[model samples]
Target: MIQLHEQGAYYFDDQIYLESEKKNDAWFDPEAGKKKTMAYKIMQAHNHSGNDRILELKFDSIASHDITFVGIIQTAKASGIEKFPIPYVLTNCHNSLCAVGGTINADDHFFGLSAAKKYGGTFVPPHVAVIHQYMREMMAGGGKMILGSDSHTRYGALGTMAIGEGGGELVKQLLNKTYDTHYPEIVGVHLTGKPKPGVGPQDVALSIIGKVFANGFVKNRVMEFIGPGIANLSVEFRNGIDVMTTETTCLSSIWATDTQVQDYLTTHCRGNDYKELKPENGAYYDRFITVDLDQMECMIALPFHPSNVFSIRELNENLEDILHETEVRGQALLEGSDVTFTLTDKIRNGRLFAEQGSIAGCAGGTYDNICAAANILSGKSVGNEEFSLSVYPASMPVYQCLMDNGSASALMTAGAIFKTAFCGPCFGGGDTPANNTLSIRHTTRNFIHREGSKPQDGQLSSVALMDARSIAASAVNHGLITAATELLQEEKAIPKYFFNKEIYENRVFQAHDQIQKDLPLRIGPNIAEWPEFNALTDDMLLKVTAVLKDPVTTTDELIPSGDTSSYRSNPIKLSEFTLSRKDPHYVPRAKAIREVELERLAGHDVRQTDEGLAAVYGSIQNHFPDFEYDKAIVGSVIYANKPGDGSAREQAASCQKVLGGYANIAKEYATKRYRSNLINWGILPLITPDEIELKNGDYILLRGVRKSLEEGSNRFEAYLVNEDLQKINLGMEALTADEIQILLAGCLINFNKKEVLV
Candidate 1:
């Protein structure tokens, strides 16, 4: 069970006290207590803004995988970056299984190698490691801060404070600029109990996520792990929980370091990087969470989200009612499609049955988790049903260790397929399940379509998240969804993990921070430059191309992952897939509007391109005879209840930008990274505090738009041109001076340089 303390609290002497209970204590001074957190210390070391209120941070290292690096490097190169200022590791894990795109995946890998050689960075070959795993094995250092372009970039368990963000944030570091943000609120995650043997880190993490995500208790706040419970878990167990902190929508996470952390770093050949980190006598937390790991049970997160969690015991007792509710939700997700999904049908003799099982990615593929699972499935078979099991180690070194220790062979002998290091299972790129089947996975997310089921293509599948132990147990039960605890068997005789650095030394291309200035850059045929972007105009018009009524919309819905991500290096081609899954007609509609804007930019009359647009202009002129067409720009916008929830993939915003998207109207943004993505792509993040009626084909016009932003106006007047002019006001949060500059210049690229490359 997890308990949330919404009221502010402080941690002292391994005891948490709310202000109401501890105001009498001498250590209860809020001002001094704020500086006692582990997060504050790490941020203080990296912050160069001269003050703690606003952090202008410089990370010690930055990283990105193939799904992101090509675009990030292209942006930095356009901004006149000559050499990487800090350690930059480009890993090829996300696109390692490239069965969908022809030769493009390998092409991106070669380009990463060329970029690494030319800019003095490190390039890890395909299957070398997933981004976060490689960072853990090599780059994580105690008391240091790292930034990555992947959402799950967490190394807090290793005593490193790491943040996952969009590519623009990485570009700033490459250009020796600062990552600007107000000092984030810190939340103390106090753990005091040891987890039961059958319960893995995913169970503890999902329990916390289920308690916190829906209420936004820790949104955009740093979660600091501390307490007596820290010493009870191994370093890898802490890592499994830390990496999934991204699901709680937290900004970043850090843990108090112990001798175990020192040992972990030492084993990875980084003993000197270890540092003692702990909360001072008293540390203030804006919010607090207490996780009782002793009561943790085998957990499962049903389809559609990682936060929709329940204990396996609870589900078994309430099977019928829960299945009915999930069936209804699944139907909503498959609405207007030919696909039909019913979880109730999976029931066989009153027990739920799934068709596939996966234990992979940064969350589940750690050395400890796999060894435990292999031990559980040592002599048992997964059976010859449709139920198949696959396992992927987090890194090649981990795989090699398993191979050396017979863990890999044990799983393979039990009919479980072993794979190399890859993140495809986490993002729907590989190991996709069959239609209408249920997959029990130990990956990071179970969001709709996250398991690579394309409902648009009349295929649908459901994914439920469980720990590797439960997944292995269910595999032995012919996918009957059994809890690992019911089997009453624990891991025994597991060998110690032996990391093989020779794997990297033999195949990885390490530039060693020495720039190869004379080396020629390699350009892949599929890699394309970004299209030209126009700066903001005094007058702006945005056509509503799509309206989503979902309570929370993820980045996966904005621009899908998997096969569509293959075109990310080419802005034009990638933009074509924008909203392709959620709104199939969005691209054509945006493209049509883009054509009209292109004509306007060329000094041609945009009214001549479309009759409806001509009529709208006439109506605008009729309302105000001085309407200025020359000072205006037209684009598209999308309205969602709350958007940008899941991944930190910048293509969610960049693809929209390349397709003529200028703004997004949402009640609130789900995560900081998504909003940053929007700003980095020059798209305005607009909010509507009150209900506003909107339709797909409606147009909203804002006069003196650029002037309002320049004047620092938080709310601006706008007209919604449905039939008659209707007054509207859209709210905008105050932007940083740099953010405003980037918007005015159209994007990060234009803000950094005046030269335009075609």
Candidate 2:
């Protein structure tokens, strides 16, 4: 059970909390109490801004996976980055499979190693560890800040405030610039009572996510975990819950660190980096959440989202009803598509089944999760039917520990396959299910087509997020949907974990400030430089290319994942897949708009391409006598209710930019990282009225957009182009000074190319 308190609250030490406004005046100071939070202390320590209202932060370290590094390095290189100023870790985890058409995946890995050496960073070889796991074991320290290109870069359980952001942010760090933002609201997550047996960390996390995600209670706020529950969970258990915070759309998360955290760091041979971190007495929280772990159930997030949750017991009781509801909701997402998304059919003879089971990635691949699965499936078998199970330890060290403890052999012998450390299963690079099947995983997300189902090709499948304990329980029953509570007997004692640092030392490449300035970067055939982008012009004319009426449009739907990720190194090639899943016509429509811009830039565009545009220009001239047709920049825009959920890949916005996208008009952005990505790619993030009507091919002229931004006006005037001009107001909210400059310069690369440092 989870309870939310949006009204500000104050906590005395870690155990007791009282409403801030209702608290006694004996010792109440909102400002002083605000400084007592663990998140505030860590952020201010990393803050370059002298004042508390604004933050110009430089992280202790940064990280990127293979799918992101090539573009990040190219952008940083184009922006005049001499060397990495911090301990940058480049891990080859996401694109580990060299199974794409050519050698692009392997090529990117080589490029990462070269960049690590040339820029004085670190590189973890493919199958060595995931980006987050490596950071947790090797780099994370108490009170340290880490910024990563991947969205699940949360190490809060270990006293580190790590944030996963777009690649542009890392490029800023590489160029010695700061990550700018204002002070964020801190939400206190008070955990009391220990988790019951068979209730894994994912169960507790889903309980909280189910309660908070829909209401947006904790969105964009830092979740600060405190209370007596801190001492009950292991470091890895806390990590399993912490990583899923990304799904709640929270900015970042941190938990009160204890001896367990100290032991975790000490075992990883970074004991000196451990600093005791706890919320000081009378800490103030803008929002407070209490999670009763004892009431947790074996939870399941049904297909299409991580928030569409239900207890396994509840699903079993209402079997057809729950599945039917999910099928109906999922069908809505695929309404115009050829494939029929169904989940009700997965119910076989009153028993639900999953075709596949996976326990991997930063959340599920921990030693604790893997051991729990092994214990549940100790003497049982997943069977030799269509059902299959696979396990991937987060790191080679975790894998070694699993092997040492005999869990790997036990599960493998029980008919589950054991794989090397890789993030493929988590993001659709490996273990993809057959068409129309369902995969129950302990991975971070369950977005549509995330399981590698190509709906466009008449293939469709879905993923249900569950704990490793429940996944193993279901696996032992030959994929019968069963909670761990039904099959789990007495809890077995887990073996002591021995951190194997030598595995990384031997396999990973570490650049101890030995920068190779003269070494040429290995340019692979698949890797390509970004095309030129123009800075913001005087005014802009935007044609609505795609209108997504979906409740939320995710990054995966924006640019897609899986095989398309093979082209991530080449911006032009990758752009071809923009909105391919959500809107098949978006690319061609956006490209047509881009062609007009290309013609205008050539000084030959005079209504020759399309006569309708000439008429719109005449109308614009009637409204403003000084209106110049050639001066207005032509680009495409997309409207969504809420966009930018799931994944911190910059390609979601960058792909749109490469295809001549100039703006994103949304009622509200789903995450701060997504909006930042849009700005970093030189796309305007506009907040429009919820009832504002927009259709594909409708044109809108933004009058003096550049001048308005220069004048620091949040509201911009635009005219909807039709037979008659209709006025509309667009809002750009809370943009920082640094963000405005990036937009004006067209993008972070172009902005940084001028060597402007903040």
Candidate 3:
């Protein structure tokens, strides 16, 4: 549980936290010298190029979740990549259930397993482990750097610096291309004192998250943990807090190591992994955040987002006012939806009432949290009713530990069903609630549709985030929504844990080739090959198939994954539903356009007959009388202010590219990883600011687009014309030197294809 002051507070001298009227300068710009100094030492470790925004460095390993591995592998395969350049772990946690395209999910798993075997990579079967959890237990090490396809890939808690990037960056790694970035400033997240009993790390983290997330205090900055609290917590606890830092959207994280950390690595059979890391005594920090754990209390993040937080006590004491304020804020964020949600509905019985409870995913499905939940739920029946509770272990090892230590029996005996380590419930993929149901969970995200709802089609389910302890505490009372602190005050109970490593020793396939040969992998048929894409042309005629007016469209809406996850490997089948969920009419409109492009490419003379083709062709012919409609390749593109956010799912980009998508037009991209994926797959990364009028359904013709890209020109002339022949000038965004060449070559594959010619 956690407590937060309305005003910002800072811990000074590791003793007390007081209201700090001063700005957060420790991160913005800290004192010049002394222990309070926050700075960057690693930038000194290597040289970089381009704007300081790009960094080039060597990494210890790379990883990807269910959503990203399929396309990352497909891109690498296109680039003639035969094997992984570094240790790559493909975990099937994101799309564990075969929800879409019949067998698409299973096919992707097969592709992963086969690629792992063929390329000597590591493969984690569906529901075996979440991507982040597996990486922490098996891959993290001191002073090492890792790149993952998922944006939440942060391992700095264990002395490892890991980055969550777009799949294009991962493709570069797979193809032996260097990860480019300007070095980042390291902000010291100085921790002091131990978290009081009954309080969890989530409490401390939410407090920090509340302060930093909204203002982008640490955006694209590295969080380096130091100070005395590092000695108090276990490596797993540190990792849990570190993983959530992704919610803050920071670049990466690293923590100072101690004996508890060393012993944890040693117990995992990685004894030599012990290494203590800290910045030089007076290392500079762009900023400093000193967290005093003693004052922390139990916390809860309300529905919709992890950043919506409040102390249970405050909400209970001032329920009416808080709920009213929350309603106003929700209305503002929801944009005029009849989202009839009111926390004050619980005020009738003088208590909070939650309909569902869940303890799952990388944030909550830990050995200690599960063990603690088992202890709380033991000997107490959850009562057969609508308030159901489910517990999911993060990995087989944690599951085995719970069973071996009698924790699993405790929860099961108490009427709670234990489930596999699937990431489904966290996303909309698994355990969806009925319409209007409100579920409370201890998961990574609680975004819209994250708990399984389709708002566009009129179905809405919501999830509120809580720590695992509180989830069980509420379930014990049949969902009266009691806080964990209240239960602890009534009865004191602390569970002991016994680490069990035998299951991993027996079941986990180590990174050895001999052991890998005997393991058989499964593949299904719904998987399809990636379609061929033409290179950037001297001139391009692009038809805007989809235009999203939603302020922020999540990657989930672009390509609904929870349902279509199973079809990740099959290009044609998956493309059919490109914008089906978001805009039900998108597929037919896209198909109509595709037909004209198809006939034009096939050399059919349909210019005079086809209405859709006649207008588009007539406009192009007026500009360059010699231009041939059949010779000009046509494709679709999606425009949004900012896209490619939330999940690291590559299908969001791949599905569009496969359905004849040639580019993405956006004001800015959400993450570096998503945009890179667009470029690698032969889609143009187009940027047309507010000055350009890019109307939906209009044909924007880019003449010498390929040459401009190859020549590394930032600005190029493009003509925007309707079927009526009216024309206007449009411009393209400047690209990095390498980005331009990749576009001209038709994608990374074509670039590599030219290698054979060399």
State in Å the error of residue 712, model 2.
Answer: 0.7
Summarize candidate 2's per-residue lDDT along 298-319 as a digit string, tens digits: 9999998989999999999999
Q: Which stretches of candidate 1 lie over 4 Å from their true place?
A: 489-493, 755-758
Ranking by TM-score: 2, 1, 3
- TM-score against truth, every candidate: 0.98, 0.99, 0.86
Candidate 3: tens digits of C-alpha lDDT, residues 256-354: 777777777776677686677665533555555777776676777876677778877777787788767876655454443545655566554766677
Lowest lDDT 10-residue stretch of candidate 3: 30-39
Positional deviation of residue 311's Cα in model 3 after best superposition, in angstroms: 3.3
Greater lDDT among 1 and 2 belongs to 2
lDDT of each: 0.89, 0.90, 0.70
- Candidate 1: global Cα-lDDT? 0.89
In candidate 1, list every pair of residues with a backbone clash.
none
Error of 1 at 642 (Å): 0.6
In Å, residue 382's CA in model 3 sits off its true spot by 2.9
